[model samples]
Target: MAGDLGLWGIPVAIVGGAIRVSTPFLFVSLGEVLTERSGRINLGLEGTLVFGAMAGYGTAVLTGSAWAGVLVAALAGVVFGLVHGIICSLPKVNDIAVGIAMMLLGSGLAFYFGKPFIQPTAPDLPAIALGGWSDLPQVQAALNVNVLFLIGLALALVMAWMFRSTKVGLTLRVVGDSTDAARAMGLRPAVIRTLATAAGGAFAGVGGAYLSLYYPGSWNEAISSGQGLMAVALVIFARWNPVACFWAALLFGGAGALGPALQSVGVTKGYYLFYAAPYVLTLGVLIATSSTTRALSGAPGELSITK
Candidate 1:
């Protein structure tokens, strides 16, 4: 029975897929956590993600340096975040509305500019050969992890601690809780939120960099596939905790990888249906946590959605 279904390969493929697929989710969710923690939401991260992919790929193509591409992508995210932050800070401007607009704008710009680089080849990021000790090829393939994934894991731990122990984290929490309270503390809410939003964009950009320079490793318009928008829901599902976001991302990634894993083992029936698992999981998570009577547990007080 163990060998009948290509037993070991199934789990191995799923595990490998989870690690590969979750990097974008991890980065975007972390960025969203930061943005939402500052009492602002940048739904436009979808645009940022797409744009980052293009910029990162184009930079890598031009400079022959994947690292430079990641850096440029991050800068692009900062610019997008700054734009979203500034516009949303205006009186009576709806954050959601501006975010939608930004999404369109970002994607449009990326498509137009990225057209040139679509045919060009870019350097791919190198992976850590963690599976070299494994004698089995399946085990070796599954164990090969990327550096960005490790960095993401380290970031989650640092974020969890920062939220609990740092002055900057506390200040972010304070602003996220109440604008009036933040002002009373002599902190400028607008400035803080703008900066925070930009920082969040930077994270999203790196996530974009990972998508193009690693994983599927290419520049294309359709690369993001709503991961940025979904990260918003992911933030809520994570209860606004960074460490929770990490685990949640892997769960999402695993769900995403289910179809491919099954197909790799000759389970092709209903393959397309399996691809929907992540969306179904996202919907289920939203349904389970959503409440009309009160704010969600761990939600920031000043978030408009909770209000």
Candidate 2:
């Protein structure tokens, strides 16, 4: 194992792990970016994620098709997003509080429905082969990448382009920056926010589906470990940029894989600490970048959380 590290195998392992594990984070962070760009926060994304996992796994198990699972999970995510949008739009209702409630509701629903999916086996998603050039077994293992990673990267680029160059993106930014200004321009802030939330939910749902149908092929209570929540922090760390979200998610994925990679290489001491690397990194970044003054400076003016 030490020899493997000496041979630069660790870097391959890290890259492979990042590609595999970052899919969920990428989805969640991108979703959060969309929501925040629309001047709202959906803390309940954790719930959307878990429920999407359950829905995806259950659908795949029943329908025998991974695509069916993805579609169903996306639909469920939209429902969760719509619910969040409606609740947050109510007069005097705190969006944060509603987010928390939605989280509880989503998690509870997932737990209730996920009981059947806790079994040892389920249909897994097919992987696209991209390591054909590697002759060494370890190299192949380390080079193998999931197709979803490619899709995620493409989505990031698409989103970045949309945000930077599209009329719809301009309207979204305007609404997020100032609801009053948007209203003055005949744009409905509520409608924009609702649509963004729903779209974000769909992305988050796909993230959950990837978890259940690809990286880990079984459903259980412990299937997700705050990936959804950390994704929210990641979006902030990325400054609400979808492209940055992609890199941030990959970084977080590498952090997450450190412990397992070490264990695979015959080092297991401080395993628990390694498992916490992603969260610790998240906290550190938050502390470094977040401040009342900076929030006021960089955040959309109409965003209540920044205020």
Candidate 3:
């Protein structure tokens, strides 16, 4: 017998892991969606993610309220986004370079502040029982989705509506499409980008908060594992659509859980390969979507990366 490879177990494990793993990606992807839609890219989201995790966990431990921790993390993310936006807006300072620098700064800041939270045990986010209908234990566990997961999905839908229907979303898209056009239309490109970056950072911060307060409590050097960076790649894979980011996040989450699921099944031979699935999938998506032959296509036209 190859263990209990029943009809219910594997799917339950995957669904559970996808719900858990998708939290961070959902936040990061959503944040990137906002920033990119405003005609800028924040590579420093990696730093924002780590620092947010540390800040959120530390705050929750101190205040005994996970919500308070989320607030503090969002604030920290705003500050990081402001710094990143301001630096990128300056003449001669490339967005890519600024993003890399912010990543280092964010990671370093997390390491500095995360020392005390390295211990086991901190306040965690509460989960909502959406699977009460299922009598099976596996079904219940799989359906014990976190409140943040629901929030993330809601945010995606709201953002999609905004991007397609709202004035602010229209302005963001216009700014991303052409800076000169924005300037002509009396829109402040710098202000729009700065604000968008801040909003994006806040989202990323929430993602970090989920990591520390929900999925995996406590903090350490390996707390993040490049989830933030992979999120940037995911935004591209999702074609900068928040709704698509949600689905992409779920896919990435499933890929992320493959190794652990295999281990649970008593298979560990290709563990490392499973770990690489998300990145491999991301690269494949990028190659499929991007084309050097067509100049300024697929990506936002005014985006620095494409130019």
TM-score of each: 0.97, 0.95, 0.95
Candidate 2 runs further than 4 Å off: 1-7, 296-298
Query: What are the lDDT figures for the candidates, one per model?
Result: 0.89, 0.85, 0.88
lDDT value, residue 132 of candidate 1: 88
RMSD of each: 1.7, 1.6, 1.9
- The residue pairs in collision within model 3 are none
lDDT of 2 by residue, 30-115 (tens): 98888888899899999999999999999999988988998899999999999999878878988788888888898999999899
Please give the distance, in angstroms, between residue 274's alpha carbon in candidate 1 and its true position after superposition. 0.9
Q: For every model in order, what is the number of clashing pairs?
A: 0, 0, 0
lDDT of 1 by residue, 193-247 (tens): 9999999999999999999999789988788878898888888999999999999
Best by lDDT: 1
lDDT of 3 by residue, 4-104 (tens): 55644666777778889998999999999899989998999999999999999999988999999999999999999998998888888888888999999
User: Between candidates 2 and 3, which one is better according to lDDT?
Assistant: 3
Which regions of candidate 1 deviate over 4 angstroms?
A: 1-5
